[model samples]
Every structure is written in structure tokens, then in C-alpha cells.
Target: MSEQPHPPKREIFDVPAMTNTDNKGFLRPVDEYRQLPYGLYMSRPADHPRFHHLESWLLPALGLRANIFHFTPDHRSGQRLYLDVGRFTGPDADGRWYSVDWYLDLVDVPGTELELLDVDELFTAHAAGLLTLDEAVEATEIAVRTLRGAAAAGDIQSWLDAQVGGRMPWLDRPVAR
Candidate 1:
């Protein structure tokens, strides 16, 4: 019997760090994990101080990223999407903010985009008990709107080209350098 070949590893994510915490996200403690825009993300531990926790990823790859779905306002259609990970907290959880992560691929899902927030932020948000279902919907809706608008105006293909900095079929137009 021949063995099946393994799928190529996705560079989008960095190698997992060795830590006492053994959480790896696919669909996790937070179903909303699938709702944040593209970036690394994690959920809060059962109990921790600060009420929120977030760590940094390896260099270069550090940025806001999310897994989101693209779709119409009514969610009549949907597509899986992502943005590069960006944003982090200071030592004492000073100012809180999220940057405009890069544009991610939008595979067909339903036209209703799901924004997967950065894992670290998700963890922090969940830990702080600041996360809410309504907020998740709003996040996803924002990404969906951005994607739809970019597709209409053609800013995304160029942005996508910049994100990969390589030639890809997804670009409907010739990406400018």
C-alpha cells in the first residue's frame, strides 16, 4: 500500500512554543476563535491574574492575524478568510489596541465571513471576561464588509499580493509591485 503524502506546512503559523500550557487552537474553548480576523490567538486559562494574558509570537511573523469568513450582510453567502496577526499588550496591560492586519485568502465557505481574532487577544479578552457574542458578530461583520468592499474596488488583490509578496492565482489582476 502506498502512503498518502502530507500536506505542505503552512508558514502562516509559526512553530509552537514549549510551555506548560498545552492549548492548540483549531476550534477551541472559544468557538468565537473562528470569528476574529487573522492573527495568532489563544483563550484565557481557567484562572489567571491580570484577568487577561497574551504573549508574543516569533519575529517577522509578528503582526495581527485573524481567521474570518467573507459574506453578504445578511450572511446569504460566506467564505473562510484570514488576516495576518498583529497587536499585543505591554507588561502591565497598558493601552489596548489592534492594528490593521494584512488581507487573507477567502476560500468559499458561505459568503458570510468569520473573523478569527488573534489567539493571544482572544485569550486575553476571554480572561478579562470582556468577550461577548455580540462583539464577535460585530468583528466578523467588519471584516466581511472590508472584504466585500475591497473586492468591489480591487484594493484587496494588490494588498493580497503585498501580503504574500509572490505571484498567486488568487489575484484576479496583475499585482503591482
Candidate 2:
């Protein structure tokens, strides 16, 4: 039998870097990554320091109530990245459960500001053959409609709290200096 054709190589989504260094290290929501051509992986390691900083100083200092999900690398370059399927899920404040799973990319970008990388593009790309489709139905079923709807109404934080709920304890664990 003839050898099967290989799938296309994964392309890194070139998320535009912000020129304003003033807010370079802050974690914030980005709408553009939601429509990019590559996958977005959660950067848990990059989030460790900032997450601690947020819990220990920022949020408390400002009297702000917010919940942050896993951090996504927001750097312009460097490091080898890999894509693995993953899922994020939790209950809303009312106890309704919701979840989103997709191709999670992992990269090493020290000192990079971590932001959420939208995975809808991953689903789209997978559907189009730019990305792999290991679980066709599960991959195709990826939907953030409810999440986006709440986000559009400026209630993303509240929704995130309901879904992903509470501070990540791992971020608060003591680390050797």
C-alpha cells in the first residue's frame, strides 16, 4: 500500500505584540487571539509569579474581585512549543457546569506577560486540516458561546468566577528561592 500523506505542519499563531510596555506584565483579556490561525496553550509556569503577586499584593491592594484562569504566553518569539489537547471546566455561581477543551500549546517564554489564548481558532483550523483532529466530535463540539455571550456583556469575570472558581492554590505554594 502507498504511504499516507502527512498532515500539515502546525503554524504558530502570530499574536500581535502590544507596543505599550507600560502594561507588558499585566494579565488581561485579549479578543484578537480568539480569531488567530494557531493554537493557544495555557502557560501555568509563567503565571506562578504573577498569580502570587496578584493574590499577595495587587488584588488585595486595589480591593478588586476577580478570578484568573491559566495564563497563556503573550510573547512575540522564542522557544519550542507543543500542542496537546486539554480542557477547562467548572460551575457557575449558580452551580451550572460549563467546559471548553481544545488543543493546548505549551511554550517557554520567561518574563512574558500571560494572557488567555482563544482556542476557537484551533477548532476551526482542525476542522480545516491545519490542526489535527484526534476527537472529531469532541473537537467540533468546542463552543464558547455562553462564555462569549457573558464576556460581551462585560460579565466575563463574574462568569469565570462561576466556572473556574477560586484562586489556584498551586500558585500560592512556597517556592525555593
RMSD of each: 16.0, 16.4
Q: What is the Cα-based lDDT of residue 89 in candidate 2?
A: 26
lDDT of 1: 0.33
Q: After superposition, how far is residue 25 of candidate 2 from its true place, in Å?
A: 26
In candidate 1, what residue range of length 10 has the lowest lDDT sum? Answer: 27-36
Query: What is residue 121's positional error in candidate 2, in angstroms?
Result: 5.7
What is the C-alpha local distance difference test score of each model?
0.33, 0.30
Off by over 4 Å in 2: 1-85, 88-101, 104-141, 165-177
Q: What is the TM-score of each candidate against the true structure?
A: 0.25, 0.25
Tens digits of lDDT, candidate 2, 119-171: 55555556667555654344334223333433554443333234434322223
